[model samples]
Target: MSPLIELRGVTKSYGDHTVLRGIDLEVAAHEVISLIGASGCGKSTLLRCVNGLETIDGGEIAVDGDVVSGPGVDLVRLRRQVGMVFQSYNLFPHMTVLQNAVLAPVKTGLCSKEEAEERAMAMLGRVGLADRAGSYPDQMSGGQQQRAAIARTMLMSPRILLLDEITSALDPELVIEVLNIVQDLAESGMTMLLTTHEMGFAREISGRVCFLHGGGILEQGPPAQIFDDPAEQRTRDFLRKVSLAGRL
Candidate 1:
């Protein structure tokens, strides 16, 4: 299958500090790939680059055959095909759940309000939030708010989703609810690039697991191989640290 997203020699840095180096990666259509690493290892930065939220200083990023970060790429259009869900439930508190979900399609694509609301209702239902359609973000828990955020992104009908540690900011009990919704999406054939510290979920759900460290991907493979028998010393050591810390 052709890759839904591809990167070649991608690098990103801020002034004197480099966050990613010579990164080459790809996400196949309908595949769920997880990037797992300790804090500050550039996993989140990599996810940002995938969705055009962060600009790379050099190299190329392509999403569905269109250049995303290289010459001649229209980032505005590219982003419409790639949606992002952040750790914080970045919902507009002023809008109801359905309104927040439908805003993007109605504003960016100039879709009719009625059509957008219908699409939004369907997506919110997919995430099991149909009954709460008129609730404001502030009226919900973190889990519900995040689910609303996911629904909002889904209304855009994106082909690829970038999740940047989306559950990190949630209460411990709320994490599983969000993760369960994501797992359902993965099972239903959504192409995803997820960065998370949730090792067990990564091992259980990802088609491939990538380990990043020191501004680069240290090792990557199928979940069984990467989690059980990583090839890189840094990966093994990092796993040990998170494991001993009771994070794995």
Candidate 2:
């Protein structure tokens, strides 16, 4: 079977600064992969490019066989199929959780107002936030807010999820709740590509792991091999440093 997501010679640069140099990857349907690397290694940029949030400077990106990079692409349609959640929990401050989750589907005509609310309520329950549906962002814990953000994304019924350090802004104690939802998503066969600082969770949950260095993929393999037996020296060094920092 062909990959559900494919990148060929992907490159991105911002004036003098370059990120994601010649990245080539393929993600099968239902596969969960984590991109691991040091800061500025272009992991997040790669995800954004995949979602068309950032235009690539070179090469091509195809999702489910549709070319998504370059001009003439319908970004709004692409985004609906490619859900993304950020570290900052970008929930609207004034909207209640239920209202936030229901807005998109109702406005886009994906569902009627009543149907969107029903679906959003069920999704909130799935993320353990049904009781908090009426609460505003400021009234929730960091974990709850992130879960709300995730619920909003999932309600789009995306074919793929791009998580850009979704737990990076949470307290250490709050990280697990978000990760647990990710764990559930993976087990439920949600296709996901994520950039993460949580090495243990990546090792535990990823179908594969890629180590990015100098804006390109340096090594990629099954989690055990990539995390425990990486062949590249840079990969080894990065793992060792993060391990010594108690980040592993």
Candidate 3:
């Protein structure tokens, strides 16, 4: 069977600066892949490209064999299949957590309000946030807010999830709570593509780990090979820096 997601010679740029240069990747069903690199190495950009948030400058990106990065793509339908969570919890400040989670499904006519609420509540419970369903965004902690955002995305029943530094905005002590939710999703066989700074968690959770450099994949392998026995000198250098910073 074909991969669930595929990118072939994908390229992206802003003005004169290229963010992704001829990247080729494939994500199989139920696989969890982690993208690790220095800041601005194009990990987040790649995710955006896949979800049709940013148009690619060259090559192709396909989800379930349907081209999504080029012209004439049905972006709204594409987004329904691809859920993304960012570092910032972009929850509506005035909306209650449950309201925020259910809005998309209701607005898109994907489900009735009652149905949306039921799914929203169940997803909130899954993320350990059912108790906070009636709370506003400002009333919750960063971790709680992020978890609510995850619940909101999950309510859409997306085929794949893209997480972009989801824990980077939280306090150190609060990061684990959010990571635990993601860990649970991984164990439940979610197809995920994540860009993360948490190397240890990536090593522990990812089925495959990719090292990105200069807008390209410098190396990729199982977590053990990428973390413990990297092949490329650039990969080793990056890991060494992460180690010195006590982040690996």
In order, the Cα lDDT scores of the candidates are 0.88, 0.94, 0.94
lDDT of 2 by residue, 1-248 (tens): 98999999999999999988899999999999999999999999999999998999999999999999999999879988999999999999999999999988888878899999999999999999999999999999999999999999999899999999988898899989998999999999999999998898799779999999999999999999998899999999999999998778
Residue-level lDDT of model 1, residues 1-248, one tens digit each, is: 66889988899999999999999998899999999998988998998888777889988888887778855667668778998999887999899998898888888874889999988888888888999999998889999999999989888888888998888888789988898999899998999999989787788779999998888888999999998898889999988987887667
Using Cα atoms with residue i matched to residue i, what is each candidate's TM-score against the true structure? 0.96, 0.98, 0.98
Q: Which regions of candidate 3 fall more than 4 Å away from where they truly are? A: none
- Give per-residue lDDT, candidate 1, residue 11: 94
Worst 10 residues of 1 by lDDT: 70-79
**True-vs-predicted CA distance for residue 174, candidate 2, Å:** 1.2
Q: At residue 138, what lDDT does model 1 achieve?
A: 86
Q: On residues 1-248, what C-alpha lDDT tens digit does candidate 3 reach at each position?
A: 99999999999999999999999999999999999999999999999999988999999999999888877998879999999999998999999999999899999999999999998888999999889999999999999999999999988889999999998898889988988999999999889999998898799779999999999999999999999999999999999999998779
Q: What lDDT is reached at residue 39 by model 3?
A: 97
Poorest 10 consecutive residues by lDDT, candidate 2: 102-111
Q: Which stretches of candidate 2 lie over 4 Å from their true place?
A: none
lDDT accuracy of residue 102 in candidate 2: 90
